[model samples]
Target chain A: GDSVTQTEGLVTLTEGLPVMLNCTYQTIYSNPFLFWYVQHLNESPRLLLKSFTDNKRTEHQGFHATLHKSSSSFHLQKSSAQLSDSALYYCAPSMNYGSSGNKLIFGIGTLLSVKP
Target chain B: GGIITQTPKFLIGQEGQKLTLKCQQNFNHDTMYWYRQDSGKGLRLIYYSITENDLQKGDLSEGYDASREKKSSFSLTVTSAQKNEMAVFLCASSRTGGAREQYFGPGTRLTVL
Candidate 1:
C-alpha cells in the first residue's frame, strides 16, 4: 500500500515570510504522481499542484514542488507567505484507480498559518 | 463547471443508529469516492466505485458501506454510529479512477449523540 507523510503538523509564518511544507511519500509505482491539496476553513480540498516527473519542478498559483524519487519527497514551497494562504495542506501519492481501485492515501495534514 | 452536492449538510444521530449520506455529482464521472475526515488524521478513503455497481474497499472501509446505484449518484452508510463520535464525510468524483483531479463536495458533518 502506498502512503504519504507530512512531517509538519503546523507551520506558522509572518506575512512575506517564506513557506516550506515538507512532504514525503512511499509507493511501489515507478511513475508515482505526487499531489498537493489545499483546504480552507469549511471548504473542500482543491488541487494545488501535482507532478510525476522526477526532479522537474511544478509550479502553480505561487506555489511549487519538485518530486524527488531518490528521497521519496515532493515538498511544497512558496516564496512569500500571505494571510490568504492559511489553510490545511495535504500530500498524496498516485495509485491506479481502476486496476487497483484504491483511494488516494493522504498525509496527516499540515495547517499553515500566515500572520500579517 | 460541475458541482458535487451532499444532502443534509449536517447529520446528528443516536449511537448504534444506522445513518446514510447521499452524494450527487453532475460531472458525469466514471468514478466516485467516499472519504472520512478527522482532525489530525487528514482524509482517509472509505470506499470508491469506478462505475455503476462496482464497489471497492479502501483503507478505512470497515464500518462503512457504499452503493453506486447510478452513474451520477453514490451513497454511504454508517452501519453503526459510535457515541460522542464526530467526523466529516466528503464525497468526490473523478473523470476516471485514474490519477487526476478529484472534485469534492462541501462535506457532511456527522455527530452521534
Candidate 2:
C-alpha cells in the first residue's frame, strides 16, 4: 500500500516570509501522481496542484510544488505567505490511470499559521 | 464551475444504528469517491464509483456500503455505528479517472454516541 508523509504537523510563518510544507511519499507503483490540497476552516479540501512528470513545477494560486521522483518528495512552496493562506494542507499520492480509480492516499494534514 | 453537495452538514447517531450520507454532484463527473477524515488526520478512502451502478471498495470500506444508483448521486451507509466514532465524511468527483484532480464537497461531520 502507498503512503504519504507530511513531516510538519504545524508551521508558523510571518506574513511576507516564504512558506514550505514538507511532503514525502513511499509507493511501489512506477507512475505516481503527487498532489497538494488546501482546506480552509470549515471548507472542503481542494486541489492546489498535481504533478505527474518528474521534476516539473506545478503552480496554482501563488503556490508551487515540484514532484521529485528521485527523492520521492513533492514539497509545497510559496515565495510569500499571506494571512489568508492559513489552512490545512495535505499531501497525496495516486497511481497512474484508472487502475485504482485514481484513489488518493493522503498524509496527516499540516496546519499553516500565517501571522501578521 | 461545479459543486458537490453533501446533505446534513452534521449528523448524530446512536451505537449500532445505521446511518446514511448522501452526496450530489452537478459536474456530471464519471468518478465519485467517499473519504473519511478523522480529527487532525489524513483522509481515508472508503468507496468509489466509476459510473452509475458501479461500486468499488477502497482501503477503508470495511464498515461502509456505497450506492451509485444515478450518475449525479452517490450515497454511503454505515452498517453499524460505533460509540465515540466521530469523523468527517467528504464527497468528491472527478471528470475523468486516473490522476485527475478531484473536486470536493463540504464534509458531513458524524458523531456516534
Candidate 3:
C-alpha cells in the first residue's frame, strides 16, 4: 500500500517571508507522480503543482515543488508568503495512470497560516 | 473547465441509519472517485470508477458501497452510520491517464448523531 507523509502539521509565516512545507512518500512503484493540492476555506481542493520526473521542478501560482526520487521528497516552496496563501496543503502520491493501478493516497496535510 | 456538484452539502443522520451521498461531474472524464476526509487525516479513497457502470473498491470501502450509474453520476451509500461520526466526503473526476490532475467537488459534510 502506498502512503504519503507530511511532516509539518502547521506552518506559520509572516507576509513577505518565505514558505516551505515538507512532504515525503512511500510507494512500491517507480516513477510515481507527486502532487500538491491547496484547499481554501469553503472551497474544493485544487491542484497546485505535480511532477513525475525526478529532480524536475513544477511550479504553479507562485508555488513550486520538485520530486526528488532519491530522497522521496516533494517539498513545496514559495518565494514569499501572501495572506491568500493561508490554507490546507496536501501531498499525494499516485500510481501511474492506466497501469492496472488505481489508488491515490494523500498525506495528513499541512495547514499554512500566513500572517501580516 | 467543468464543475463537480455534490448534493445535500450537509447531512445529519442517526446511528444505524443508512445514508447515501450523490456526486455529479460534467468534466467528461473517464474516471470518478470518492474519498473520505477526516480531521487531521488526509483523504482516503473509498471507491472509483473508470467508466460508466464500473466500480472499484478503495482502502476505506468496508462500510460503504458505490454505484456508477452513468458517466456523469457516482453515488456512495453508507451501510450504517456510526455514532458521533463526522467527516467530509469528496467527489473527484479525472481523465484516464497516469498522474493527471483531479478536479474535486466542494465536499459533503456528514454528521452522525
Candidate 4:
C-alpha cells in the first residue's frame, strides 16, 4: 500500500516570513507522482505543484517543491507567506503515471495559518 | 475551462435509506472519480470510471456503488446509510489519465441520521 505523511498537522507563520510544509511518502512503485494540493475554506483542493522526476523542482504561484526520491520527500516551500496563503495543504502520491483508474493516496493534510 | 457540477449541494437521508449523488463534467474527460472527505481529513477515493459503461472500485468502495452510463456523467449510490454518517463527496475529472491535472467539483455534503 502507498502512503503519504505530513509531519506537521498545523503550521502557523507571520506574513512576510518563510514557509515550509513537509511531505514524505512511501511506495513500492518506482516512478511515483507526487503532488501538492491547496484547499481554501469551503473550496475543493486545487493542484499547486506536482513532479515525478527525482530531484527536479516544480514551482507554481510562488510555491516550490522538489521531488527527492532518495529522501522520499516533496516539501513545499515559499519565500514569503501571504495572508491569502492560509489554507489546508495536502500531499498525495499517484499510482504510476496517473493512468485511468489509478488512485491517489493523500496525507492527512496540514492547516497553514498565516497572520498578517 | 471546464466545470464539474454536482447535484444537490446538500443531502439528508434517514438511516438505512438509499441515496444517490450525481455528477456531471463538461470537460469531456474520460476519467471521472468520486471521493469522500471527512472533516479535517484527507480525500479518499470511493470509485472511478475510465470511460462510458466502465466502473472501477476504489480504496473505499464498500457500501457504495457507481455508474458511468455516459462519458460526461458519473453517479454514486449509497446502498445503506448509517446513522451519524456525515461527509462531503467530491467529483473530479482528468483528461485521459496520463499525468494530467484533475478538475474538482464544489462537492456535495451528505448527512445521515
**Share of true Cα-Cα contacts across chains kept by each model:** 0.68, 0.79, 0.71, 0.65
TM-score of 4: 0.93
Model 4 complex DockQ against the native: 0.66
Residue range A3-94, candidate 3, lDDT tens digits? 78885688889999999899989887888888899998777799999898999888999999999999999999999999999999998877
| Each prediction's TM-score versus the true structure | 0.95, 0.92, 0.93, 0.93
Candidate 2 error regions (>4 Å): A97-99, B97-99
DockQ for candidate 3: 0.69
TM-score pick, better of 2 and 3: 3
lDDT, model 1, position A61 = 97
Question: What ranking emerges by DockQ with the best candidate at the front?
Answer: 2, 3, 1, 4
lDDT of candidate 1 vs native?
Answer: 0.89
Per-residue lDDT of candidate 2, residues B7-111 (tens digit): 889999999999999999999898999999987767888999988998989889999999998999999999999999999999999866556788899989999
Q: What class would a CAPRI assessor give candidate 1's docking?
A: medium
**Per-residue error at A40 for model 4, in Å?**
0.5
The global C-alpha lDDT for each of the candidates, from Candidate 1 onward, is 0.89, 0.89, 0.89, 0.89
Clashing pairs in 4: none
lDDT of 3 at B83: 100
Best TM-score among the predictions, by candidate number: 1
DockQ, per model, reads 0.69, 0.73, 0.69, 0.66
